[model samples]
Target chain A: MTSLMTPKYATVKSAFWGGVREAASVPMLIMGASFLGFGSMIKDINWSISLAIFTTLSTWALPGQIAMAEMAASGAPLLAIVLAVGFINARLLPMSATLLPHVRHPRFPGWAYYGVAMLIAATSWVGTLRRLPDLRQDQKMPFLLGYGLLLYCGSPLFTMAGYWLSGSVPLPVTLALVFINPLYFMLLFLQDLKDPGRILAVLFGAVLGPITFLYSPDWTLVITGLVAGTLAWYLDGVLKARRGTDES
Target chain B: MNPELYNPVWVITLAAAVSYASRGLGVALSGKLNPEGSVVEWITCVTYALMAGMVVRMLALPIGALVHTPDWVRFIAVLVGLLVFFIIRKNVGAGVLAGSLFLMFLMW
Candidate 1:
């Protein structure tokens, strides 16, 4: 429910800079550490830093990138690797769709949505979902562009660093670096515990996800998402209806 | 023939295309649908569930180096981070840093 045309920032330039400044903080550090870990991962598999950088730029989604690299290293077929990565990255679809409502502005080029969608990784998506509501409609795209571009460019550098410093980084440090991604996500979701439905979704997924993984590792994500999400939605609707009746 | 399928360039190119197609399709689909509608909310719920599942999967049943650490340590570390995060008034960076360090310290 954003207005299609409304001026928020003085110019797209200001909005872009605003995003840049914001990205330079926590989002950048979290992403940098994760990519550093990824870089070292690819290096461990004897892949070149350039290839690591290539995947980082192209895939942008760390999960998909990791799946592709790991699967490729294990001699998985091309189609299998592609499908697995695609499946993992499918979360981006809903994220991008949700964002389009807010980020849409008359001044923003329609075609650029796809390009911006390319940059819609977990970190950016979370940042946008949390922060976009506070922004004016016009500022959304430029701000995202500014924020996304910085992380996008800086990631390859972290990857390269991870690649070069692969062996030197201690095991504990590397593991902790890896842990940062999930820890950040968990804490981020925990902080957003206000909504009952969303809270249920998180709880259901946390419990159901592990159970599904035991049976079907490849499809656990989709299965858990569909089952948990639909259940949460249904229960939330029932709860809302009950509350309304009680009020009456 | 098998090696060709695993070629880094081809693998990355095709994988990237496949991955990006979902995101592009989402944006395109949004133009036809109402953002304020229930469908969008359901999609959002589904997205959240999916993400939470992914994160939990990574934490509870991890791969590679993280597997070396006991599950209790990882879970406890998450609890510590959550506590820090809220106590610090939702400072995400500090929370994450605290959690990571706690994990590191425990492993030490």
Candidate 2:
């Protein structure tokens, strides 16, 4: 939810409407298509529809869920698979925390965001950040809820379609579907970079994580986020202060 | 049984429970932490930095399907997407779509 104090913004109704508009626009389509591919993967691998839907409802984090599903398909141990997926998603805690305070209604103190957040994903988080800054706090949650529900319902259908496509689809086409998941999110971040340090952070994190993963896959994200995040913050602060001094 | 062929219902159930509990943990912690405070402010910055790092990491070093795309191509697509996103007033859907389609068209 965004701060209502902002001078100009959308009403709760309008914000949710924007969410609908955004969800249907491009991200949803990409997600729908890719999830269709994922569904195909699920079915081809013989995971039940129930399991796939359960993944949607339960984990909700598409990247991690996909990792879990695909790794499991390859005969990875349940614990190891879950751990790997969980490790990837550990960034969500920070993602959620950074996002929640910016939107939690100061007046509506009793509202519980847990249930709503339980359904959140990397898609919705990126989606909401893209919209909610100019909306009221109250409007923020509803916008996310509406958008998430629409996207959520599509998962099973895509899964069913993907399962069908997996068998007959040519290898190149199949590769395109698989690529959509990460590509979808990556492009969103590129658009959202306002701070120069974030640009640096992205470069460092991206470069370091893979290099580190080659040596130790498990600790790559964890180590990269801490070191890289701190560096980004420090750099941003330094640059901002320098700008402030010049202005003064 | 080849584990992939059949997941015991318990595995699904346990995974769901754990996942939900992790989120609930975030909400509970949020209740205690004041968002406007200095530490929390710092944490928020850290979160953004971390998320940025993660995103960059994914583009720079993808695990599965993304690894196949050449690095320079991926980087250009992302940059193009960012340029479009800002040009279009920070529309996330447009930014990501343009970037992806750029890569898709070139690669395809």
Candidate 3:
């Protein structure tokens, strides 16, 4: 997407600044707070603030960072820690593909994509999905640039703050503090759609992951995603066709 | 390792690299992903659903400190949080605080 960002309207300078401006929304705040909680969790586990911020800057993928932080805290072996965190972030592959389609220009160098790839995460991706359709094809990159930068700068600060707080807080408060991250996600999705099939897919995925985890923890999300996503697709297709026929 | 002092650069690096690989893999797999047509929408939906679903489960059936509190109380807090968002006209921060405060209030 960075390649497509033209020198004409969406210059690198403007796009960088655009990313800064867009990050000021409520959703961004939710994401920032949640990451702050995560940062505290990392500090609670005794990870270095500098290293955690480094991960924030370079890794940018929060779930993966948290998984690594938790596993390392548990004294898992280095290789196992890497593998598990990687597995948790397997979803990013599709996310990049989706967002890349909108942002990538034919003339854009591959390396730009690589750099942009560093900033990808759930919060920015969600914002991009909502914002991309409204942007000119040429403008998408700047929008993403702005959005990504917003998150990029905010996350590390939150992590630093979280690291500072995790120790002084009590256990029950700490436990509740943890809930802030995931709960923020739920609220973000609350008004997202009137699409029944999509909503059903979300509901199914939500229920199936944990339930399946009771049997097979590692595979639950993959299994549930395949099952629920497939189900939602067909259900939407059938509904669409039925509506078409009735219109005829 | 004690829960209070370890350098975790290796862990952070592994995670970032892993995340980058996933993002790159998507670019490589784009041709096969098939975002259009019947199956793809469902796939995206399912994938999103799985993500959302896992989150809901985590909150609904939290394994840690949330376990110490009664399930009804936690669920009610979520409900109250959602209610306040509507009651106050869709404020995200308000809803989150309502949810957080409800939990804390129940514990109190």
Give the interface RMSD values of the models in order: 4.0, 5.1, 4.5
What is the CA-based DockQ of model 2? 0.29
How big is the positional error of residue B90 in model 3, measured in Å on the Cα after superposition? 4.3
Residue range with the least summed lDDT across 10 consecutive positions in model 2 chain A: A1-10
Scanning candidate 1 chain A in windows of ten residues, the lowest lDDT window is A1-10
Q: How far is candidate 3 from the true structure (C-alpha RMSD, Å)?
A: 5.5
lDDT of 3 by residue, A1-248 (tens): 74465333356566556656667777578777777778766666555788878988877877666556644654655665566556557667777777787787766787787677766777788877766765666677777888887788888898887777666776556655666666666776676657777787877777786787677554555567677766776787788899999999
For candidate 1, the TM-score of chain A alone versus the native chain A is 0.72
The C-alpha RMSD of each candidate to the native structure, in angstroms, is: 4.8, 6.2, 5.5
How do the predictions measure up, each by TM-score? 0.77, 0.64, 0.74
Task: For residues B5-28, write the lDDT of model 3, one tens digit per residue.
Answer: 444665677677777898887776
If you assessed candidate 1 against the hidden native complex, which CAPRI class would it receive?
A: medium
Candidate with maximal lDDT: 1
Candidates ranked, most accurate by TM-score first: 1, 3, 2
Per-chain TM-score of chain B, candidate 3? Answer: 0.63
Summed backbone clashes in each candidate are 0, 5, 10
Clashing residue pairs, backbone N/CA/C < 3 A, model 1: none
Weakest ten-residue segment in model 3 chain B by summed lDDT:
B1-10
